[model samples]
Structures are given as structure tokens and as C-alpha cells.
Target: MNRFGKGLLVAALVGVVGMAFRVSWNALRDVATATGADETAAFLYPFVVDGLMALALVATLVLTGDARRFALRVLAAYTLASLVLNYVHGLVPQLHDEVVDWGRLADWDPANWALVLLATSLPVGSIYFGSDLVAKVLHHRPIETPTTTPNQDESAETYVNRSTADLGVSAPAPITPAPAAVALPAGPGVSLVKSTDRVPVGAVAAESTRPRRATGRVPEAARSSRPVRTAEELLIEARKVTADWSDRELTAEGIRKAVHTSPAKARVLRDTLRAERAAAREASKQAARAAGPGEAAA
Candidate 1:
């Protein structure tokens, strides 16, 4: 429906409900006053009765399954309660001036006692059943799970290691250098010998040949200083950091962290990498055109 149409409908609904409450309001108040309610209690009586009926009616529309059925029962009960109060109001023209005479049932007074109890107990029932209806509606409310922020250090590592693999570029894990060899003291019955040394014939006759020491040791690398890392090398490693990046934007700070380089050098490498990638993409498009339909397109 159009906005104006909805507004008109809503205004009409309000007017109708207002007029209904105005009419029922007097009858319910009379019932409350006749049932020995005080001034304040009698004034609020219509709202407690009619309000619960309206609330339950709306609850039936919102609620589902068993909850809907429960709301429907509440609506019916409150509706019946209102009907009884209005019936009592119709019978009694002078509510407080004269006591209601129940004809033959006057001695037992069960019907009058029941109507008074129902009228007075409505507020209590509204509090209980209204709260229950609200609880049922709340049960269907969608729960929002609070999200936590990622750890900064872990995020950086994730961007470097995992994001790189996603970007189709990855650097191998750093290789640990082999530990240096240690020299051991020569043991008893062990002898150091040259390849040229010969064993005597009597030595072969012994129960066991004496253990021989190493003729020579494996020589360690002469140069011990760390090798210098080139810009190209840092750019290659830094590819892992920027490759999986959605924006595909390279930053000097990110490059510096990835390859552990100076900020100035990182900036230089960043520009070089961007240019290289751009050129590579251009080459691919050109190659795709050249390849035509004969071979797999670039």
C-alpha cells in the first residue's frame, strides 16, 4: 500500500480502538467498583483487562508454534473476562448504591463471588500472562555474537605466510645453518695415522686391531660473514606480504617487516615490484592475443 493509504488505515485503527476502549472502559470500571475495588484500583481496572486482551491478540500474530497457541488461549481468556465484566455492568444500573440481587442463587452467591474474583484477579493475571507472552516473543529474537579483533602480530604473520600462498607467490622457510664440527680427544688404544702408514704382520695376529683416528677433518667454509641481501631478493620475499592483499597496494612499512630492510630500500623495492607486476600483466594480455585460439591463452 502507498504511504498515505497506510497512514489513513493506521489513523482509522487508532480511532476505532480508542472508541472501543471508551465504551468498554465505563463497563469495566463499574464492575471493578461494584466488586469492592478502591478508587485507584477501579480506575486501572479497564486497562488491566482490555490491555491484556489487545497485547495477547498482537502476541498471537508475532509468536509461532506452541507460543502462538498459548497467546491465543490468553486472548480468549481475557476476552471472556471482559465479556463477563460488561455483562455485570449491564445488569447493575446502580453499582455501589445497591447490592446485586442474584434471584434464586442469592443464598449461595457463587456467581456473584466468582464475577467479583474474576474482576479483581485480572490485574494479577495480566502481569503473569503478559510477562510470559513477552518472554516467548524474546525467545525468537536473533542473537548477535560479538566478534573480537585479530591479534596484530598474528595478523601480520597470517598476511605474510598464508595470504602469500593465496596470492600464488610464496617464499620458502629460512634454512637453519649446520652446526660446526667439534674435535674429540684421542682415546687409549686409538692411534692417528696417515694413509701411507703400513701395519706390521704381528699386528694382524693380535685378537683385535687397534681403533684408528680420523686421517682428516671435513673443512668448514672459509667465509663466515652473512651474505648481503639484494633489493631484488627482498622484493621477491616481500611478494609474499603483498601478493594476497586484496587492495594489491604495496607499503614500505609492510615490505620492511616482511624482508627486514630499511624503509628507504623497502620503498624502492615496492615501486619496482608494482612496475614488474604491471609489465607482466601487459605481457600476458599481448601473449593471449598472439596465441589466438590455437594454444592455451596466457
Candidate 2:
């Protein structure tokens, strides 16, 4: 509802509740007095009733989801209700036997004025309860921050060492360089052997010196295989070969050769080129019409 509508509703509720509390308080006080209750109990009866009303208001504020708005409404309603009840209590001769004229409030005893102040202050003091209720209603659970464990803080080397110890495995020894080889006396037709491999050095040297030849023919497997070409690459190559040729002179075979694509792709490229040319011609005609007769003639 709009703000005005909500305000009207709250005002109506406050009127109804205030009237109900007034009636109930009078009835309870009468019953307590008639039942031979002590003077102290009868005297404190109205305060008890007001306290219960305040408690109910606090509970309503606490339970509602929109506690903030409800708390404000409750405060306004309680203030209005308190003022109305206080005025009624002051005016009614049966309720307040002491006759203090409205214009003579300044002349009234300090104790009587103090009592009036306390009664009005009761509802205002409940403002704190409303605030507490709102806080409780709208409170949210705190988010937990992420924390690192001891293991996560350890270095890679430390982790590896710990793991090896747990598994009862020893780490491998560090690698050491071998001693330099001593030269032996050269014998006829003897070849030097390297420590890295068993293969003769002469064979590797011979392979490196051999000449390489280029073959124009593709391998049987490669010739049968079809390579993937993007639509952009095919269109680019098709445009290049067909740039100097008219739409009628362009052929699927020429496009396939220019882009090295399959027959099906070549046919698609041919159709695309025809569509593009048709579109261009249509655009030129539209531009000429828009330019008018004088511009066309020029």
C-alpha cells in the first residue's frame, strides 16, 4: 500500500487498541477492588496493565518481518494513545479525584506533576524496547572467513620430506659427475667410443651429411585426407580468384583450386558469390533511385 494508506490503517488500529485497553484496564481495576484486594495491589493494577500492553507491543514489533517500519508505527501509535489516555484520566472526576484546573497546571503540587510526567514517560521509555526488537528481528548470521591450515602453509620441499617419512621411503641420492676419461694409445683402425651412447660416431656424421630431396607428389594417406578450412578463409580465396572474373565466368573448380576445399564447399562458395553480387546490384539501383533524375543523368 501507499504511505497514506498505511498511515490510515495504523491510525485506525491504534484507535481501536487504545479504546480496548482503556475498557480493559477499568474493568480489571474494578474487579481487583471489589475482590477485597490490598490497597497496594489495587493502586499498582493500572501500571501492571500498561506494562502488559507495552510487552504485547514489543512482542508484535519483534515478530514482524518489517520490524523497522512496524517499530516506527508502534511508537507513533503508543505516543498518541498515551496522550489520549492521559487527557481522559485528567478530565474524569471518577478516575482522578484531585481537581486541578487545566489553566492552573503551574499551580499544582510538584508531586502531582511528577506523577503525570512518569505516566507519559512510560510509553516513551518503551521506545528502547522497540529498538531492541527491531535489532533482533533484522539480525543476520555472520559470514565465516576462510583460514589456512598448517599443511597449506608448508613449503613444497617440507611437504615432500614429510610425505616420504610417512610412507617409509628414502629420498634418492644427489647425482655426481663421473671422472674424466684418460686417453689410450691409438691403434690402427681404432675408433673412440663416447660414454653417452653405444652407436658409432661415424654413422651419425654420415647421416647428417646426406642430401634431402623434395617430392611434388603427396602421400597416399594425405591425399585421401580432408583438411578443415574456415568459411572466412574460403570466402577470401574465392574473392581473390573471382575478382577479375564476372559471376558468369566464375566456376566451382576455380574456387576449389584457389582455396583447396572440397567440391561441396566450392558449390556453396559459388552460390554465396552470386548472392553477394545480386545484393550489390540491388543496392546500386536503390541508391540511383534515391539520388533522383538529375543526379542519375550526371
Candidate 3:
């Protein structure tokens, strides 16, 4: 989800958790008071609190894809077991001690011990919290190699050296010199695109006279770098050319027809497009250098 949606969802969850906490606390307090239990004993309510909390956390994290599904499943199962135990204990209080001796048809129940262990030990919560902390630490930790074979390391180095040699490169290779910059040709037949400044009159006129090609041809590097009509200016020229033919909808074919060319040739004209872009970049850089210190500061 986008940022706003995520924020709204988190806010809703926080509200739900806050409401659940208040409701659970009041219910627990009422139960303790009726049993004549010490109010201080309510401090141990977190174990039970955790049971419900685990269930909520498991459900929320699972739906949101925030936590591992396996961990959430474990929490969910534990919470379900706790819920069943509470229900069983409340419905059949005698079952809390009714352990049957099959041979004698007699019983010794130990369910009360189970309830005490569940409440005091907080086994599920302890495991869940510990696992979560460990997971976080492991997630951020740089993983170390679990095993190392000397031969594998040697082979890796050998492969690197071999690849460099095959490419006619030396290990720890030397840097190469950059190519010389070409000057952009100027005058009546040249166009330049300077994004940082207003379009020039010379560029506009050059673009108007430049012919559109009709087929694809890989432009020679020299020609590719040669200054030609700029695209923005070319589009303006095209707009003027099409003004007479504007009654019809224009397509690639329509534009080609107006230019008396094919789509393949138009692709070749892109070399001129590249040249214009390059010239524009050069112009912008020059403009930047020419700006006064105060202008740059501003």
C-alpha cells in the first residue's frame, strides 16, 4: 500500500488494541473482586493478558504479512488451547482434579495444576517474545559463512584472474583516457536544444529546413555527433507544416506522409535527435559555469 493507506490501517489497529485493553482490564478486575482475591494479584494478569494479546497479534501480523506465518500459527494454536482450558475449567470445576485410575475406577485430578502452570509460567508468551527478539537480531546481523572449503576460495580467485586475462585486461587494471569533446557545428542548418535557457533563433530556423528521413539506417558515429536540428524546434516546424493538413488525425504514418517518408527512416533521424540532446547538455553546463557566484548562491 501507499504511505497514507498504511498509516490509516496502523491507526485503526492501535485504536482496536487500546479498546481491547480497557475491556479486558475491567473484566479481569471484576472477576478478581468476586473471588475475594488480592488486587495486587492482578499484576499477574499479563500472562492471561498475553494469551489474548498473542491471539490478537497473531491475527493482525498474519493478515498484514508482517510476521512469519509459522510463528503466528504457533501463537494462534497456543491461544486456542488457553481459551479451551478456560472454558473447560469454568464449566466443569471438578475436572480440575479428576485424574482417573483405570484399574481401580478411582480418580486423582491434576487440572488445577495445569491452570496454575499456564497462568504463572506464561510459557507461550515467553517463547513468542524470545523468538521475536532473536528473529529481529538475526534479520539485521551480517550472516557469516557456516562452512568454508579452502579449494572453493582458491577456485574463485583463479576464475577472477582467468576472466581478466581473457578480456585483455591486467589484474588491478589501469584507467583509460576519455575521448575528446566535439564542437557543435553552428549556423543556418544547425539546431541546438538548451533545456536551461530559451530556444535560440538560429536553432529554430535550422530545424525548419532539415529534411525528415523515411527509413531506418544506423547513423555513423561522426554524423551522430554532428550538430543538427533540435527535436523541440523540429516539433514546432512540424506543427507549422501540419497546420494545413490538421483536418485529419495524425499518426506515425500521417507524420511520415507529411514528411514524405516511412517510419523506418524516421528512426534514423533520431541520430540528429541524440546530437541535439548532447548539445543541450553542453549548453546547460556552460550556462552553469557562466553564472555569477551570487546567482549560484541564490
Candidate 4:
């Protein structure tokens, strides 16, 4: 509904509640007076009943679980009590003129005693019960539950495969390095071993010359960082690395890994090392052929 319609509805509700309260207030006052209240006491008695009803109604809306049910019970009891008093007021036209005579009912001892007790004690009851209910409701707390499931920990393999799938590439299988191939960051000075499997791209391995410590800490020397070596310096290191090689099948990839240089620079370094090895082999073969005649003559 629009604001104007809402405003009109609220105004209408206020008018209706006010009219209802005005009608019942006098009836409640008459019931108090008939139940043995003095003139001054009767005047303020309507608030005791009506005020508790209001509090109970509001509490019923605010509370939950057992507290809500208690509030509802309080509201229903006060509402019924108010209805009974209002009904009594309607039965006697003399009550409207403030000339109610309770002398006949007062002669019945038990009935009059109960009526007086109910009316006099309700204000004190309203004070304690109504205040306690409101306090309990105000202090109430609720446990909140999570609405969504939390994410689980991701494994390195799953992360790698997912990342590769996103890039539209096949996930590479794990491979062992070739016998002559060196691991990336080989400048750290690890022992080289012979293995027949090819090392796939972005793969690396490490083997220590010393046995691993069972204490689970890497040796201090193994934890050292790689020193910054230039291209020429790395080529010098690479020549020393390949000097004990069994064949001339050294790859640029392996050279780049061993020395931590660019692919282009590794290719140049590999070509230079291969040509040097080839020339040395040729000179050795020529020397062996030339010395064969001299050895035979001797």
C-alpha cells in the first residue's frame, strides 16, 4: 500500500482503540468499586487491569518458546477478567449512574471474600509477573546456524590440474630425469645420478651426497641460497658439469636448468660445449691413428 493508505489505516486503528478503551474504562472502575474499593482507589483501578493486558499482549509478540506461551496465558486471563467485569457492568443499568449496590452479594461471605481478594491483589500481581516476563524476553538470546557449507582444503595436484585445464593444456605426468640431465638450480651443488626417464617441463629433483638426517631438518649447507651467477659464469659452470659426461646428448633445457639461464643463452652454451667436445674427439682419433704406426715399429 502507498504511504497515504498506510497512514489512513493507522489513524483508523488509533481511533478504534481509543473508543474501545473509553467504553471499558468506566466499567472496570465500577467493578473495582463494587468489589470494596474506596472512591479514590476505584478511580485508578482500571489501569491495573488494562495496563497488564497491554504488557502481556506486547510480550506475547516479543517472546518465543515457553516464554511466549506464558505471555499468551497472561494475556488470555486478563482479557477474560476484563470481559467479565464489562459484562457485569452491562447487566446493571444502575452501574452507569454510579449507584451500584453490592450489599446482597456482600452478605454471601465466600463470594464477597473472593471478589475482594481478586480485585485488590491483581495490581501487585501485574507489577511482579508483567515486569518479570518483559525482563526475560529482553534478555533472551538465540543461537544462529550457518546457512552455507565451508570450502575444504585443496591439494597441490588438484590445484595444478585445475589451473592447467583452465589454460587448455594437458596436465603433464611426473617423469624421472635422464642420466646426464641436471636439476634446476643445480648451482646449489647436489650430487648428480643416472635415471633413464626424461624430466618433463617445470619438473625438478634433488639428491644429497650425504645421507638424509633422521632428525627431519635439512643440513645447513643444503639450505643455502643460489649465488647470482652471470651468463658467462654459468657457462663456465656448465662446462665443468658436462666434462664427465658419457655422451654428447646434452640439451638446452638441461643446460638452462643446471645454470639458471635463459633458453637462448642455454642453447648457445650447449652448442659451444658440443662443438668443443666434437673437436676434441676428432683430434684424439687422429692422434691414435698416427701413433699406431710408431707403436707397431717399436
Candidate 5:
């Protein structure tokens, strides 16, 4: 509920408790006087009755799950009971001997006026106390702290290494260096040779001089005449070409011109780029799904 509604409920409860206290005190005092009880007993009688009432209220609060509704019902019942008892007591001949006119405020004695004010305030007091009690009881929870040992001071790296060792992870192999490229002689008619073949000095192996089969098919060795570019090399070239081109200029023609390759190869590079992007997106989605539950628990 809103703050204003809660305030009103509190005020009403306070009034009810006050009225019950007044009624309990008056009843006890009358009984004590009739039995010739001493001054101390008379003074402490109301507290006993109020304590019992408090215990009864707490018992009711604990037993019921819906405390707000229970408190409201208690406040209403007590207010009605107090009103009925007040009406009945006013009818008694002995009680009416010094009755004041409630309608005439100026004619009312100060003591009598104070009694009336206290009686009116009882319901408000009852509502406030009842609602407050229920709120405290229902919302209260015990706090839990993590248990730890004084001797436990392990670092994260130690834990990770231990876990990996237990899982039987093998040591990584040492990396080997790649062989250096062969340098060709720098002169007229001295051409660069493919890595797979050896050419003698002062010999010119022209492309047109290469022999072809009777079936007009090139030999496997002849097919590897030009060095084949690796996937990494193709991807690097594609990236450089895309970086230089605007969004509107990213067509097959632009890619061919930028990378100095044919249209078919440019198309192949674009398809590879799209496949890599799709794989990256899938990996990100899988990572998010894996971490979702852990994040929510935290």
C-alpha cells in the first residue's frame, strides 16, 4: 500500500489499543475497589490485563498468514465492542450520576473532556500498533554469512593450476620456425621460380614453352606453375579492399579492381567474409546462452 494509506491504518490501530487499555483499566479498578485491594495492586492491575491482550494479539498475528487483513478485522471488532460497552455502561444508574453533556463542549468538565478524548483516540492507537506488529513479523528474515576457515588463503592461480593438473592436461609443444624463402637472381630474363621446382643458372623457362597433352589438358605440375594464395592471404586482401571502398562501392567490380583479381575470385572472397561473420555471430550467441543462468543467479 501507499504511505498515506499505511499512515491512516497506523492511526486507526493506535486509537483501538488506547480504548482497549482504558476499558481494561476501568474494569480492573472497579473490581479491585469492590474487593478492597491495596493501592499497589490497583496500580499494577491494568498492566497485567494489557500484557495478556498483547500476547493474544501476537498469537493471532503468528497464526494467520494474512496479517494485514487479520489486524484490520481485530481493529474493527475491538472498536465495535468498545462502543457497545460504553453505551451499556452509560445506561447504568451508578455510572450516570456525574454524566457530562457530550454535545455541549463548553459545559464539559476538563477531566470528563479528557476521558472523552482518550476514548476517541483508542481505535486510532489499536490500528497503528496492530499493523506495525504484523509488518515487523511478516517481513523479518534472518541474514546468512559465508562460512570461512582462518587457514584458507589460497590464490586463484593456484586453484586453476591444481584443477588443470587433476584434469590431466598435457604440456603444449614448442613452435618450429618456417624455412626462409629462396632469393632469385636479379637480371634480364631471370624469372621467379615456384618453391616446388629448381631452375639452373642462365636458363629461361617461358610459360608458352611448357608442353601440353594431346587431350589439351595442362599437367598437375604445370597447374601449380603459379604459387597458390593461402586463405589468410585472401582474407587480408579482402579486408584491405573493403577498407578502401565505401558502402555503395562494395560491388564485385570494386572488389576486383581493389584486390587486382578476377570477378570470380572477388565473389569467392566476399562469400568467405560472409561465412566468417556468420560463425562469429553464432559463437557470441552461444557464449551469451552459456553465461545467462550464472548471471541470473548472481
Candidate 6:
């Protein structure tokens, strides 16, 4: 059986058991009331039924966790035994008073009898077939052995011998490194040819030891105020580009009218412009500083 079938089986059992509880409760309550018992005794029926339900629920969780045929069988047996004992306890002449009358054939109380029958029936039925039902749902099928012909052993040995001889199971040879080459970087006004072949470590080391070109081109000064762009300038430019309209107001048409240049060019121009302004400001400040305090006061 599959999960759906097993689940349906368990659900059916629960329904039957739950109906038994309802029957037991009503029967016990009516019997207790007829006997003029106290409120406590009358309440015992629901308490006992609910207690059994809680016990069943706990057992179900524990048994389902382990999920073995033996575990389920034991659980079913436990429920069966409890149901039988509870039924017998309720039905025993000593346990309940017998209402007797002379010269009368009496019916066994319908309510009490029905409850007793239901309680016994559900658990007994469950125990007899429940384990097998659960096993079918959960157990793996058995594997079968194949019947072999007489010549099978001889054929197998012959195949193994031929396979091993063809395989040539020997150790492999060690690997060797490739030879290296020398290369140079491109120099100004000289047509440069790019090397497709990789230069080796030994050749590279020899080239590094040789005299290098001393081209007299001065590098840009790091400390020079030469207009420089900062992150702040880039963000300011982005804001200015969007300043004319709200996000919603900037339709595709409005955006097309706003800027004709590509974003890349705009970014480069914004950075260069910011740097030039900074350099000019720095030059003016330096000039003012060179003039001295007396000149500034005048």
C-alpha cells in the first residue's frame, strides 16, 4: 500500500475510535445520573474518554516516529487491550447495579451495550490487520535470485582472464617542462609586434638584467593642483542631470531633450570640469598666500 492508502486506514480507525468515545461518554453519563451519582462521577465519562484520546495521540506520535511493523503491532495491541478492559469494567455486574424486576425479560441497555461493542470492535480489528496494513505501506519488496546454467562459471573465468591481459596495468612515465623564450614591450613611434608565444621564466630573468630605455618623458605630478575629479563631483553632476523634473516627470521624451551626450561622455566631462575648477581655485589660494598678510590687510 502507498502513503495515501495507509493514511486513509489510520483516519478510518480514528473516526471509529472517536465515535466510540462519543457513545461511551453518553452511556456513562446516563448511567451515572440514573444511579444518582455526584457531579464528579458524571464528569468521569468525558474525562476518561478524553484521557484515552490523548493516550492514543501520544502513542501514535511515538510509534509513527519509529515506523516499524512490530512497533505498530504493539501500539494496536495496547489500544485493543485498553478498550477491552474498559468495556469489561463498565459491563461487569459488580461494577454497575442491575435493575431487576420479577417475571420480566429485560433488554440489555442499548446505550451502554453499543458503546461497549464499539470500543472493543475498533481496537480488535485494528490489531488483527493494522500491522500488515502499515507494513504494506512501508516495507521494501524482497529481491529474487536468478537460476544459472551449468557453463556460467566456466564462461565467467574465461572472460576475466582475457579482460585483465588486455588492460596493461602498468605505472606511467614522469612529465617534462617546456622551453622558454624572450620578449620585449612596445616603445614609442616604433611599429610594435605582439608575441603570441609565451616567454619563459629563465629568458624573462635574462632580459630584466639588460639595460632599459631611458626615454625623457616626465610623469604627471601627484601633488599638482591640476584639475582633479572627486566622488562628490560625480554625484553632484548626476543630481544636476535629474534636477529639472521628479522621477515620474522625467518621461523618455523629457530625458531625450535633457541630455544629448552618452552617459560615459557625461561622466568624463563632469570629472574633468570638477578637477579644472579645483586646480584654478588652488592656484588663486597659492597666489594669495605668496602675497603675505600685509598685502591682504591693505
TM-score versus the correct structure, for each prediction: 0.45, 0.27, 0.32, 0.47, 0.27, 0.24
Q: In model 5, how large is the Cα lDDT of residue 199?
A: 39
Q: Lowest summed lDDT over 10 consecutive residues: which window, candidate 5?
A: 98-107
Candidates 4 and 5 compared: the better one by TM-score is 4
Per-residue lDDT of 4 in model 2: 100
Question: How many clashing residue pairs appear in each of the predictions shown?
Answer: 0, 0, 9, 0, 26, 3
Candidate 6, TM-score vs. the true structure?
A: 0.24
Candidate 1 residue pairs in clash (backbone atoms < 3 Å): none
What is the lDDT of every predicted structure here? 0.75, 0.61, 0.52, 0.76, 0.58, 0.52
Model 1 residue 265 lDDT? 94
Query: How far is each candidate from the true structure, as Cα RMSD in Å?
Result: 22.5, 19.4, 26.2, 22.0, 27.3, 22.3
**What's the distance in Å from true for residue 209, model 1?**
60
lDDT of 5 by residue, 90-183 (tens): 4443433324233222234684455444444444555566556656566745456657544454555656765665556443443343455578
Q: In angstroms, give how far residue 213 of model 2 lies from its true place.
A: 44
How many pairs of residues collide in model 1? 0
Q: By how many angstroms RMSD does model 3 differ from the true structure? A: 26.2
lDDT of 5 at 95: 36
Error of 6 at 268 (Å): 78
- Which structure among the candidates has the greatest TM-score? 4
Candidate 2, residues 1-298, lDDT tens digits: the string is 9999999999999899788767656643433343344567656655554654565466564564555456556556555645554454545444443333432223346844654454444434555654565465567334466586666767666668655555563434444545555688879987655566344344321122223355588777777566566998789878877888877677888778877788999999999998888999999999888889877689
Residues 45-125 of candidate 3: C-alpha lDDT, one tens digit per residue: 534544545554644443423445545665665566555444543554333333312111112346544544444444456
The TM-score obtained by model 3 is 0.32
In model 6, which range of ten residues has the least summed lDDT?
98-107
Cα lDDT tens digits, model 6, 146-257, are 6776589777886787556545444334334444534657578754443534344343211232234555865667346645556566446545776554545544444334
After best superposition, candidate 6 residue 277: deviation in angstroms?
99
Q: lDDT tens digits, residues 85-141, model 4?
A: 787677767767767576322446786576566666788888888888879788987
The candidate that achieves the highest lDDT relative to the unseen native structure: 4
